[model samples]
Target: MKKRSLLFGLMATLVLSFASSAVADTKRVLILQSYHAEYPWVTDVNQGIRDALEEERFTEGDNLTLTTFYMDTKRHTDDAWKQAKAREALALIKSLSPDVIVASDDNAQSLVVRYLKDTSWPVVFTGVNADPRDYGFLDSLEAPGHNVTGCLERERFQGSIRLLKRVIPDASRIAVISDNGPTSRPILRRIKTQATESNLNITGIKAASSFEEWKQFVREMQTRADALVVVTYHVVTNEKGEEVPPGEVLRWTLENNRLPEVGFWKWAVEDGLLLSEAISGFQQGYHAGTLAAFILDGQAPREFAVTTPQRGERCINLSRAEALGIAIPRDLQTVTTLFKTQRVVK
Candidate 1:
């Protein structure tokens, strides 16, 4: 009887020990994102988020539980629906109260901030362009002063124009489409200043707030613009006040014209954008993910200043340009990040 009791005690102790170890190994992360379902770049961002968590040894199905909620994929156009979806996501997040919340872009970050700022959960965001100071997310890049810090998707505007010049050797006139958002003004001014200094004929086309206006604006530029430079998609807001993919608008513009479309994201290639001297959204996600994982693993968010990865790929679709009868300059080809062929349905 004593032997039987001793065996039972041993089994109980082993079970308790196992349970403690399992609890210690489990790590949970919640991603409050906006654009994963239909957006190609968000998939890359999700992969980077996974990669970042994995780098910290938090493997999925073993030590990690990643809960992702995409609020702006299918209901991106309906403002009321988008808010309702966000509210539902917030309720779920508030219930789980995960270790960390990784937001992919400015809009996503804003959503998380709206719903989770009062809570103690840390938020690590990527692709935020408006200054942290003005946005109230942090005091400065050197010291975030809050539980929010990640990667910046900002870029060198002059470099992009130089790339455009390289791609279209004889191209001199450039048209910039902007939406007058907080992020657009600085970039427009800086790029315009630099492009003007370089003797490039650049025109800043301020787009209206409506889709019809956008189409009309594009149509107007088609007559005078040598090449179309697509600024951030922030100009193309959905009914929910969220930025929709700018590629569709550009694609519509290019359908009848023969101008080159230069965009910032690699998916722009898939969207029929001719080339990009800009950063890859996947690479940006990877960088952002690394920092987010670090913060989630007990590292302080303010410990790291805002980081901007200068490394980016120069993606070019040679066939895209050729379809428009636009020649790719040799020098531009030398520095091209990606060169591939895709059919334009016309």
Candidate 2:
């Protein structure tokens, strides 16, 4: 009987120790994505998040648990439908109640702000371009007067322009395409300002309101412009009237029309763009993950300086370069962050 009592005590002690160890070894973090399926641009963002988490000394499995939720908007046809996805996403988020919620884009950020206005959970947004004041997410960018902050992908515009200038020197007439809705206006205005200051002759094309319209718009623009530039658009509707794949449209334009196109996301570079520049989505994700780790460590979101895409040039598709008969200058070559189709063997 004494031996059995000793065994019971030993077992209880071991169980308690194991439980304590388990609790200490696990950290839970929730990553909320605006889309479930992978698109090239944001996939890098997820990769960045993973890379950052992995580099951290205290990460999942060793003191962390990463829970990622990707909202799927492929079937939604309109903004209302997209918001419906947001609502559904909110329901899911309420259930998860994670330690942190990483908003992957403006859409996800909107949903989080609208749904969790009073919640104290930390939210780190990546790839958003909306004015914080407009969404009530913050008082201002200079001082994010709320519990939200991360990185924005908007500032990569200049890098894109510089690279395009390298690839298409004679590109005085550029064709700019965008969906005509909530987000496009600001992006267009910025691009327009840049074009005017840079002496870039740009012809802006608003994408069609419906999927059919978008298709026709692309067909029409094939012969109208020297090169193509895509900007954020929220007005173009999918069949479900909720969301349209802007990247896909950009891709189709490149593959079918055989023209040089440039995008802000490397994944959106497509095969035919003479050159493209974008902040690494994965890099953005890493910034977010690191910021999230800070919050997990009990630091306030506002304590960290709001970050933007690190300045760098990543280029792609030199095959597209050759096909377009555009000579890539050495100066631009010196700054390129990526080259998709060829190796710089020097």
Candidate 3:
């Protein structure tokens, strides 16, 4: 009887040790977002990352430790604020020492990734509009050769333009407008190289410096262009150098603009832009998350080539469509998600 009891106790101890070991093997991932938490882009991207991580059996608190930091650059576009946030983020990263990092958008890459390039920690970036070479974070897209690689987000301007032509057969000329910011610079560069409208002509690419300049551009485009391709106006400033509210900017544009506006994001279309086959923010995050998961599972970032997510969503604003008196075809209507009222974010 004593021998049997001794054997049972040893077996129980072994089982407990095995159980603890299995549960203690946790992977930590940190996500760095360029915008605020309340922003739709951040929300969608975070959700996509969560889903992708869960798909790879990395559930939070079970086997995964997931954390996020938002820079809130959109609301405050000054140079001082951006640099400060970048330093703060780097300190947080050092403190946490996460196994993998996912950086979203151009600012995060330019400001944050530049510091950690070719470092020990593996990094996956999403929604990066600028050419990777510009940041010098990796060797190349095909053969990254280093520990940083992920999604390169390019606007599907051709798709959006084609949809616009289908909607408005006579639309011929378009003018692109957005705030003068780091993100818009790449877009303008890409527009010169890739955005070719066979049936329509691109009038110009204008980056507004101030609220007055933004208003002037919108009013001036009424006579010079057929449609306006709006990128982003989050950083537009007022007379006193204060950043104007983006929601206010959108409301004014929706109320005053006569030409149809094409956007490259779902939140833009929902907020007031006439139409867009917007790039899928969700897919961007999912792709980045996938890369992080693979890195956590013993794969190096250099082993995988950089990729661009090709998914897009067709979004239409019903109120804007009705206001402009443009009719979306029956087939197109079936394919799109329409918003009845413009969502004005304050």
Encode model 3's per-residue lDDT on 1-346: one tens digit a residue. 9999999999999999988997668888999999999999899999999999999999998899999999999988888999999999999899988999999998998899988987888899999988886888889899898889899888888888888888887888888889998888888777766657354577777889798988988898898898999998888899998889988888888888989999999999988899998988899989888888999999999988888988899888888989999888889889888888878578
The CA lDDT of each predicted structure is 0.70, 0.67, 0.89
Candidate 2: segments with Cα more than 4 A from true spot? 1-11, 181-183, 210-226, 232-252, 255-259, 329-346
Q: What TM-score does prediction 1 earn?
A: 0.84
TM-score of decoy 2: 0.82
My TM-score estimates for the predictions, one after another, are: 0.84, 0.82, 0.94
lDDT tens per residue, model 1, 2-75? 99999999999999999899987777788777765656767877887788678878788987888988876332
What range of 10 consecutive residues in model 3 has the weakest lDDT sum?
A: 192-201
Top TM-score prediction, candidate number: 3
Q: Is 2 or 3 the stronger prediction by TM-score?
A: 3
**Inter-residue clash pairs, candidate 3:** none
lDDT of 2 at 207: 46
* Candidate 3: regions farther than 4 A off: 1-12, 195-199
